[model samples]
Target: MTANKAVGPTEAIADFVQQADFSTVPVEVRERALAAFVDTVGVAIAGHGDGGFQTLLSTMRPELPTGRATILPTGERTSAMMAALLNGGAGHALDFDDVADQIYGHPSVVLVPVVLAVAEEVGASGRDALTAYALGFEVCCAIAATMQVREHYQRGWHSTATIGVLGATAAAAHLLRLDHTRTRHALGIAASTASGSRQNFGTMTKPLHPGLAARDAVLAAKLASNGFTADPAQLEGPLGYLAMYADSADPSAVARALGNPWELARVGLNVKKYPCCYNTHRTADAILDLVRENPVRPEDIAEIRLTLEPDGFDPLIHRRPQTGLEGKFSPEYVLAAAVLDGKIALASFHDEAVLRPAAQQLLRRVSRHESAVPPIGSGEWEFAYSVVEVETTGGEVVRHRTDVPRGDCRAPLGRDDLEAKFRDCVTFAGTGLDADKLLDELWQLETTGSAGPLLNLSASS
Candidate 1:
């Protein structure tokens, strides 16, 4: 009854795992591995008290003392699945995590949590975790590229929940040292575990998706490593991930650059400067540029208009956000905060701020329109000629067009900017913790033998 099909992402990635050893991995991949791991830790620390993070932690608390793994933000030990769930939720809580352009999702949201949880459970060193993480991130990106990702995501699926589940499976498989055959089983198991939706955006469920993916990945790997089996063609089969989730998928993109180290070299990872929707970044850039050039007294502006591609506007289409969480996906709310308040600080997303009269009034003056443009890939909307317009009291029009902006992979934030952002997140995390010391610990994470020091600091705070 087995129907043969071309190898899918699951099979392609499994082959690499069967043959790869620490010696064969390129040096650049090793370095990227280290960089991503550190970034994930930083974001997790900054997301400590987010409602989603706390809820996930509480849900997994019953599994504590399982003596299998360490949960970041709390040095508590738990089952590998439980640890992955908690740490993964923390990493994505702030929405300030890193993004891989090829996948158009937060790969580390699942990869780091699963790898770190498994590493700690097995007493694996930092080196092992870093190596496995690199492979996982690469696999995730390749599959996403092959999937004609934009189309897949537009259909209501969340890439981090769908693609990230596969990435987490790869990382867990690598850490568990699964053979090629068993790794395929892990991927197959993960296919069944994949689930999340874009409709959940702006709600507590959004962050929870990545956590669930991480936990599912851990469970998949453990089951596979212990001889649990699944259909080898789970990804390409009629009932598989691609067939079920995407209308069309190009398998060649997955195999084209199989061994080229594409992810580490060119895909370009972006770190977020703010914790809101990425779509709003273009407008934020333009608005900030205008603010710097002409301190438009908030009272002087008549109204503001923003134009974005349909795909870009789709995620942030919410008109009137009734809650702070909902405000995260509202372009109007984000723009209002940036222009009127002169900053989009975390406090701007609190309950009271979301319902503020001034915020709502400012939001009313602003209008968002979806442009008539075609997108090349998932999350890469038409950045060309995107404009934010401001009408002044004197009948003057002040406008800023964003081709790109700081913190984007194209116009990346420098080390100084990244440090500034980290400090800002630390401040938002509340006062008692020493921001400088925590930042230093992250900068030196690769050299640290275990995550013990970082976990200790987070727990104490």
Candidate 2:
């Protein structure tokens, strides 16, 4: 591996991937990364039944080449690229996958599926998969820190797919055991292949972004392993990835924080408790809190005013959402559901529930506004901040403000909560697998010889 000074952003990342030792990773980071893997698999199983997953399956299942990689919840063997695409799409179909704060996107949904697919293809051990995930996550955060997230995200780019492609490439390269040079080429190739648009936020296309990113990264790594050529400086060069996607590029941030404290440890993952857009989480939490404390009923509510950061409000584009999918990005519906049920679950976002006359009546009372003041002590890239005020017909006013949501790393979900979520997802997917056995296997993934058992169990009915 070359020294950091001798390389650019792309090469620096490759060098780190080639040299980083799995044993040296901290216990907490590895545990968190493993938890993310478990969470993604659970979510993917639930997502397998989604319309988006069915569409991708129908398109790619027939064309896949012979291979050993398994698509989740289906147990169908297919090419590594096809498996990654299907599994990645499934993991994100519900918008329930874990998120990284620094990346400003869902990292596990993209990285985990690709690493598992490639690891299965090459017979890599579970420990190796864990290491590759850590490397991929670190690379994603390092690269994301260098960009102006608001500017980059506001430009209509889905950072999960755009930036996640590079991270997935790094993980695939590591699992393939590529040397520094090939790893660099893999990153370069992925840069050109990376693409996703936030314009598709409320549609089935939204989940497809991470799926395509996973497929692109696997293809990039395979091509690089076969001596496919690409610009060595594709990340920082003129007309490169950063320059093309982000409003401003800072290659130095990627180099300055290569692996000092490890981004996985410093800027941790946010495992969601709800299966909806992350932007609505804080408001949902606040509304749930208000309802619990004040005994507020849906019928009693006269108006609901939610003040959120401008960037936070941008993705919630469907103010008058009609479908369950669109309701994920609609604060109006999320809040109404929260107030009506006193809890929001996977079933809450269904079209039947979202279109209920009661929920629609409450939606009319909900209104959103942009906050004039920025959140207190928020970092440059941290954007989730909201204040919820509910006015009742009984002449009562209740307000709650939340800077950090319940499932955020700051206030993370407990082990029991995580387990419950996993069970709920497995049941929801109707996979009929024994949740206890699967959970035990995932908890002991690091010591397992191969990921085949886990994948097999997940795919089994």
Candidate 3:
């Protein structure tokens, strides 16, 4: 993964990771990253029982060593690597973590968990943890920028796990304070294990992808710090990470992306309003807009049509999902639930909510189609959008389109909305965690003594 710092992207990245400091990060970027921590912890709390995580933990708990690293809401202690895996998976179990359009994956789920766990293991200060996270995110976005990524995504490689492993590695390596040479080795170790298939979408395995990435990253960094070695030229080599994964590799993409404009400041992160596949957010927002304005009853609707540009429906594979997890990926299910419930809440994704007779009948009334047209000036379909049209039994048609749903960088949720979301998830999980105290702690994370106690503070009684 090492390239010349003055001459190549990957090397410049290693240099950046080694040198990054929290005080040097801009105020706005730090604030956004802080908000990301609060949102991620809240959603992960709500995802406690979903994704078959409890069952998976039953198998792991017997051998899991008790340590300072804490799992969200559970108050349980485990080794740093196990905590990272558990917390990362739980953070993404609801698919509600922040997203970056650049990578088409959740960043905080991988970076935050890795930073927190490794920071705890190393007794690093919160300021250092926060800086490590930003560095990791930049590295993740940098790698994604280095190729013709449409193929990597279209071919079903979940970049969150594939690219995110390296991000996690960068964060952990930085927190571990590995020098440039060891950091390169850590990234190389990460590349060797980075993998997550899009085929796992809609299943428990989907959320587990980020957890595995987090675990692999911690392992990679710890190993490199302990003198493990890997192929130094694992990035742009003829058969390296980028060569094998990217359809078309760019020799300079990585160099151009790493902080030239600062991806965090440019692309920014998306705070999700709904707890489902991000691909379905536009459709959810659009359909909800249509129904709330029209005041049409579910039974009075004859058909609901969802239209998008090519590959828009690629991640929405389950049309008549039989389970709650499956419903998270179903536009049909979301449209039906949104129309009936007035909002897409944590309750909306429960098995009973998904399988209820009314929801199932309404689901059948939805039909999805794709086209090749963008919104005149949007340029490409990569910036995904959705169009929803509702036709009532009286033949009345109403339509709505959502290009940037609320909570997007352009249409961010306000502070009250963000805090309300955190409080709601706490209540929904019946966690009894101190939401107000936790919110204050998160906002002041940079000044805190250690990052580990923050999670322990949020643990349910």
Candidate 4:
């Protein structure tokens, strides 16, 4: 299959999403996509009662007109747009969602909700949803690849909401079965709605970014399906999305890399082991490693130093967090939790836990430094490396460097580990849903006739 070199950026992406074949997707890619689906669903269900999710629900649920889509765990049926907003926010509320290095943000959190909501609305099969997911993941990564990721990210545009809006639009458009022209219009419309700031990090608004993207994407697709119009050149034209958001935009990158080798198989998703920011995972892994190898009790620790890639430190926005949400972006809080508990768990980020006397004491001794050398990889790949040095009061220094965190594609979580995480998330949320059954259905998600049964399992009884 030759790449469509003649089409414009928006058209190329829209056509790809509209026409991609699920059977052609490699077995490994399909497996990874399903894993992402299961992981995202688990996280969304776990966020059922999150303050941010609840806030959005309270605001939007009452206003939404009647529809068939169900909000996970809550089981509130609403318009696809409303359900996408609610479920997307819930998926990311805890900062526990998965990440992709290529997109520089959470992909599944935004994409999955949009696909599921639209699929339910159209009564599309689970296979249709999975195909949309793979295509959406590809579109998000390809568009992100064309930009100066570090510069764009440092400039405060949250890629999950910004780039992810387009990805979600592609997914929703595909499931809506829009033709190439309408799909292009959907992408263009989504560009206008694409906006989020990293400045909102650590606040309820951070998760709201993806939620907003999901909602807007659904609206963009629905409107496009009904002949709503947008400038087809909105991606690369002067004063368009890439020009405004990116320091240097390569529009050709989008068309050039549409689907020769799917990004789902290439720059794969990073399934998170810890429930905090993906930025904090490598540090958490290093701390766990250091403590496990050498017995360094919290009391025996003198000082801990973290050396990270310069760009990698951008997302660790909170140095001294007063709230649990803030703590997720605080490397200091994560390191403290790791040393104190010997592991960072969902509960570790709770307000009471983050504010504990022991963790606070450790926070005071923790410091961060940026390395002179850039991270070993390209683009946002720099975020994958971290160096941790721990000095104990007993005059011993221990250091560990992590290039691949436990849940990264290079060292993916095994089936058992992923299942355990799903079960743990369900238990933590107190959603009372059957974790085993949900897991089974998600693993076989592509085989299901409709997304309704799978989505229903996520709802509370």
Candidate 5:
């Protein structure tokens, strides 16, 4: 039970995946898993109209092999790998999926797609699917935390794509019922494809990273289940993934935290209230709060000033976004939306939204300042905090600050809010399923017989 006595990184991870199940998972951890399930499915459904997922579906449709698992946005069936690929992309296409500070990435987008796809493919029960998700999510976050994910991310590697692959693989392997040996092979196989670049952040390719991870998870798990071999040692040697990506950290330490604290509970998940890059959320929240307190007229706005810690705005790379996707990475655009549009919704990131003359005018007045404190989590605030200063043409000034957004772990969204978000997403998808009924089925996931009925109930009718 001691850290030092834990097995090698690969072995420990595989053992955890192979052994974790519904009964073994803690109640809160299972609840977190269920939240991920509900949120991811709803977001993926909302992706029906998203450009990225549409483009992907069009591009890959010709080659897709048919199977029984659901394809998320379309309700059609496809191979597990194909379903995972498309579902994952759709889940993240709108940038509305859950976020996690633990991995500094989106965990559910990748893990949920793979779990749903493989669980349906293998006839696994809803409880089993939920358990698989918990297993995968913990493994992914654990690996990223141990690997110094922030640095890995800052170096232009997308941790959601790179680190997320292992999480997807873990969940897929569990749902597929791979043994310890095969699970080790699956984990090692997954590491080989742990690739995604932050350079793709503002492009259609951005959401595709998680899609690729999801598809690869199914590939790795299915391959391993069929006796595909990989040297499980690919995770730790001098040239291994951890050594190449992480700084000084013991694998055993990472192993100890696997389920002890249950990263899902300890680290927490952020169900976003906005559909933009998480980097701009707190600032957006502050802007909305300031506006709500004293509705700031767009015409009277003289300047919008935002203060953030160093590295806080690192991921919001697009200074003046030219496209809707770029706008998601632009704090100026997001803040402008908060003021001019009075809200940030799924439509807020559209090309027309970013191109509106009013939005463009307001974006110019927005400015960002750096705080003297350390970057998020280590600084005086202990998490991402933002200060917004709005000055009017008439010299009236309004100020507001936010330490955590509404949906962040520390300030978690209530069940009603989560369900409301789900209803809105399902309504947006226009899938016609009774959002309330499907939501009830989802909430009773532990009692559902298998993934088949849920997917069937969600099927567009």
Candidate 6:
């Protein structure tokens, strides 16, 4: 294959489209894809009843065509695009979706939903869908690598909603097997779909961002497949995605290390154990470890202080969170719930618990500060704590710090751990989706020969 002289937006996307295929993915990548798949479905189903997600679904129901793709929680069948948007929105509804550290974004939010919807629409095998996920996952990480995502996100763009469109577009293009030109057009069209704001982080709009991005990505690809056109220089031109979105733009990074290296292999995504923002993970881990090693009763602690990276401090900066949804992003609320309740389960976010007197009292006593370096890639400098000083009124002080947080890709959860987490999520979702059969089918998806059973679980109410 001859490489293009100058990589235009469409050409760059087309190149990836031609190079990627189901057979190209390795076994490890396939396993990770399965992990992401089951995790997203579980979370989405669990959050299917959320007011924001349900409202979005209801609104979209009347506008979509009848199709094979299933609407999770309610088991309704709808067009692939509609299913993508609804499920994508629901996945992040609880704010417990996956995150990518290097990109300062959420990759699975849009990628998983879009890919799965297409899988159902095309009758793609589980193995093929998993491969599509791997391809999409790699592309998402690559764009982030080129964009200097941390800076881009800090300057106000929500990476999950913005960078995710390109990745999702790539996935849809690859699965649809569009030639390089059409693929490029899809990428170009996706540029317009890029949108999200950090101001909505603690609110319902935050989760909706990814859902809309997923739907938009499918639309972009579908339009491209139908011969719709877009700017050929949307990514590399002087006034492209970088120029328009970031403070400083680098066009070279967009195509740098295109063949020899891949960003997806280097920048591993974070699989969240707690249903809270990624910034709060390290602190929650620190508290959980402290309580475990030297178990302390709720009444024994007097005050607590949490230190975080500069970027980490901003996301969960809420002081007074009145609702359970707001409480998920509030560091104070999470810390209080973790300390007072001993476990921050799905129920921890219940309205009554969030408004509880003891949780509020602990919330008042807890304070968070900034660290020197931003905790991003590699577990080394990510989130190091000084000492969690638990000033006890009984003339004693307890201290602990997290060397490494659980579910940190480095110290990742094992198969058993993941299974437990999936079961927990399924139970909380109240979907009655068979856990054992689902896991078995997912693991043996390559030869399953039918997506109906898998789709049925998520489709039925």
After aligning candidate 4 to the native by TM-score, how far in Å is the CA of 124 from where it should be? 0.4
Off by over 4 Å in 5: 1-4, 374-379, 451-453, 457-460
If both were scored by TM-score, which would come out higher, candidate 2 or candidate 6? 2
Query: Which portions of model 2 show Cα errors greater than 4 Å?
Result: 1-6, 374-383, 450-454, 458-460
Instruction: State which candidate, 3 or 6, has the greater TM-score.
Output: 3
lDDT by residue (2-62, candidate 1, tens digit) is 1133466677778765555556667767665666666677677667778877877787676
| Per-prediction TM-score | 0.90, 0.95, 0.95, 0.95, 0.95, 0.92
Model 6 error, position 29 (Å): 1.7
Error of 1 at 333 (Å): 0.9
Model 3 stretches astray by more than 4 angstroms: 1-6, 374-382, 450-454, 458-461
lDDT of every predicted structure (CA atoms): 0.75, 0.85, 0.83, 0.85, 0.85, 0.75
Encode model 5's per-residue lDDT on 282-394: one tens digit a residue: 98898998899999789999998888877898888888888898999999999998888788988888899999999899999988888866333345787668888899999
Candidate 3 lDDT, 1-461, residue by residue in tens: 23334445446667778768876787777777788888988887777777467765776788799887877747677788998898888888878888888888898999888888888777888888878887788888888877666678888999888989988898898888899888888888888998999888888899899999999999999999999998766787787898889998775667666666667877789899999988889988998888778899999999998888888887788989998889999999999999989999888988999999999999999987887774334545447789888899999988888888889988899999999999888777676777887787677788878534545563434
List where candidate 1 sits over 4 angstroms from the true fold: 1-6, 22-27, 372-385, 434-437, 448-455, 458-461
Question: Distance from true position, residue 278, model 6, in Å?
Answer: 1.4
Our tally of clashes for model 5 stands at 0
Q: Candidate 3 overall Cα lDDT vs. reference?
A: 0.83
Clashes of each: 0, 0, 0, 0, 0, 3
Q: Model 3 clash tally? A: 0
Q: Could you give me the TM-score of model 2 versus the true structure?
A: 0.95
